[model samples]
Target: MAGNWNNLQVPAGVRDLLPAEAAALRELEQELVAFFQSWGYQEVLTPTFEFVETFQAGSPAGDEGSLYKFIDREGRVLALRPEMTAPIARLVATSLRREALPLRLCYSARVFRYEEPQAGRLREFHQAGVELIGAGGVAADGEIIALAVETLLKAGLKDFRLGIGQVAVTKGVLQDLDLPREAVARIKVALAGKDLVGLERLVDEYSLTGLKRRQLELLATLHGGKEALEEARANFIQTGAAAALAGLEEVWQALTAYGLEKWLFIDLGILRDFDYYTGIVFEGYVPGLGVPVCGGGRYDGLVGQFGYPCPATGFALGLERVLMARGEGQGGGQGGYLVAGRDLAAVLRRARELRRPGVMVIIDGESQNRQEAAARAAARGLALVWVD
Candidate 1:
């Protein structure tokens, strides 16, 4: 048992991305960084671990116990960042506070969360994201949305929808209901899960009737094209909901101007999953993948909680999910020369010349006949056999 334990295995929800996966991840990061740079976004790096209180100091409810918390030598709670946006907000607030307004920053980072391990979910994951701080309104919102679409499209994912929503729509309606925090929490959870059935049951249990009932029902189905928006406004748009819809319309128009309307969608069903999202909330979904490949939205008040307020919007693209969605490339090919020669110098020289950085190269001692060399190379899936 001790020996078996010594052999080792990775913990659940954490993984070792093998060579090919690592290569693909690196390629994705480079392509995304280039894209962000082209858009005038400068890359930034933040600490992997941050003071836990810094997160709690956020404007909204933090990720809660999801943080991977630990007691450091100082007996203070420190945690692996659960997400980048908060830390980036802290960065903008403390260090870059006096820099300027509307800072365009990008980052490639590893975020940790203690969660159940499943397809598309990990305790540790890679997120390539950008943060546009000190920017507000539809134009800024539109820019983030457009950049998100371009980033994913550039990453080679064509089959996906940008599910758009305004948190205020949901927030507005919930506030109108005057429901207790517990019921609202339940409804939000159900809505986040897209469990209309559960939402309806909660509705009945809560005895919600009239506009409130209709409002919940409306949210459940408020996803699709612009037509969904029209329907939302016409039938169930509450006083506050109408204002939220108008803001959404402005962003929709901006997305149209960016020539990205086809990818645009209405997901009014979206809940205030994060309290910081005072305006737009969006997520990217691809064919056959249940988890979102990328997601973010405007959190206009988060930085202020860091003691420096700014309007900001951005999204994080998950490499593993994106790779799964694209379902292509990053595969190793069998293109190499297996050099079998008696002359060590000659064999080494030939092998060095034939070896491309990413390609495989094998050289064997003279004792191994060409046939044996060929067999060895063949075992490794190397196709070409060169005998020196």
Candidate 2:
């Protein structure tokens, strides 16, 4: 043990998935891919890591600090992506600009973040999501939201809630408060963490009194159905929350048309990664999980930062959390080895003949007697022994 110096262990907060779990994940990913494709969402892929400056544009409260960063060979800082929306926006602006307007792109990618490992939190995780680019309306937003619900239902989840919010409602509150930049940043950090005490302290620290103080407190509780929207509209109309409110109402109407209203609720307190999300934001949650299995929303101006201007909205579902919610069921059941005794070519031919969609027929590695071959085949769950 002492002489073997090359450690084969992976870093903390990451793990190697065994065969069963890996196969299950692959199956789930394929289901999502097929679902997204069915909705006319074309697939796209981006780099696992990119230049550090890529994430620095109008950065969110904690995004910059949360990145796993390092210096490249050329002395440029590169970071494993902490999220996909920004990078997808960059992709739309750079490479795919000439394709068309109102692009529908989906991706299954591994994103990295330097967060402590816990139940639903991982340093490395896979995200399956879509970005609706060049689209600016409630219909697009509603379509994305509806697609998300359908995907989850297809994944076999029975119970969950979708909490939708308009970030503009909160932004309007911040705008009206007109707190200093530092103060606004503090409030964002608190809100992103859903920390009410922190919000109260920040309000007091900034000497935000009267309407501003009351509004911030109310924002924390502004989650639920139509009442929440009504309250938000009433409070934020004077503060320029009208557009966001209208957009939320429009999307609700569309979602209603899709008969998905029962699964959705409004939460004006819902502010996501702050740098990009310009409008409606939503998160999907299920029982027995402390974190949302899926979350995303609108980012109207993200692509513009990459030298092209377009409005976009999308969401990424956390695959690990999804599998957690779904649980480890029976392993993937398939045919096992087909041992070739005397006639290897004939065995191979038979194996090929036996192979079909979603089924496997593996040729035995070496020649064996019929008894030995059948024993080995039976050991591997293969009922029939075809040894010629």
Candidate 3:
């Protein structure tokens, strides 16, 4: 029993995808790949693991604890990639250095993060997204968000909203507070979690007054559409956040051109966990899910950390989260051939003949006759090809 238990179970925070689930995932990936390609984004792949430094350059200070690390052959540190953006940045700086300006790259791969597993959070999960390298400004940001919305729609998610924000605005507002580093960090945590009570407590602790208190409170509580952005601009215009708000305004205008206003809203409080985000950032949400289905933002500084300075922006969708949001069931319950016969070669030939793209075919020589073959096919949710 112990041996059986050991063989049958996978580690926590990871799961085995049954055939149907795997098929569904493959179909989703293919559809997304096609959609990305249609947008001039070329697919690129990277190693599942890279040197720890690669990720550290893009992740935040305390994020190191989440990396799955180990020692390498030469006694150097290595870690499975927690995300693809940094690795792709490394690739662009080294291999694709000479690639023309405005490289559009996309990838669909598994990312590992040593975090507690929850309803939508997993230590090991799949992420698919794009990197629009060497392109900066509102057009790129708008395109990335547009692509994300369409991708979710492609995945069949009907009810969702993407909240967009400018980290520059958030950072500007924080810098204007002139608070201690520790205090600022705490305020950021509270804002990111939308904990207004904690934020109020912090304001009380710091003896914040007037505009400072109002700014912090607004950052924590402000959430809505265009009116919300206008409200933010009014509150932040006199502070350091004015420029960022202007930049966000341009991006918002561009997004409006895509007719995506209904799918997006402005949330100045949307501070992504990654420290690499230097400009616009956004996260997609589905009702009833505890996590964002997808997220990413501009990291113009990420590639430059690899010694090639460039502007870039992109987003990534969590495949499992998307599937969970869409409530997709295991697919492929029918339309497969189960060829069975008395002669082995005949069954093999029939199975081969039945093979085609998107079709599943199985050979069954053990069936005694057509009746047995039919029963077997029925049991397996497949069609029978009785050959004698």
CA lDDT of each prediction against the hidden true structure: 0.82, 0.82, 0.87
Task: List model 1 lDDT by residue over 268-291, tens digit each.
Answer: 776533577888899998979888
Task: Give the per-residue Cα lDDT of candidate 3 at 227.
Answer: 85
Error of 2 at 217 (Å): 2.8
List candidate 2 stretches off by more than 4 Å.
1-8, 178-182, 197-209, 329-342, 364-382
Q: Summarize candidate 2's per-residue lDDT along 126-192 as a digit string, tens digits.
A: 8999999999888889988998888888877869889898887788888788878888878877876
Error of 3 at 18 (Å): 2.0
Clashes of 1: 1
Prediction RMSDs, each to the true structure:
2.9, 2.8, 1.9
Clashing pairs in 3: none
lDDT assessment of candidate 1:
0.82
Best by lDDT: 3
Off by more than 4 A, model 3: 1-8, 332-334
- lDDT (Cα) of model 2: 0.82
Q: Estimated TM-score per prediction? A: 0.89, 0.89, 0.94
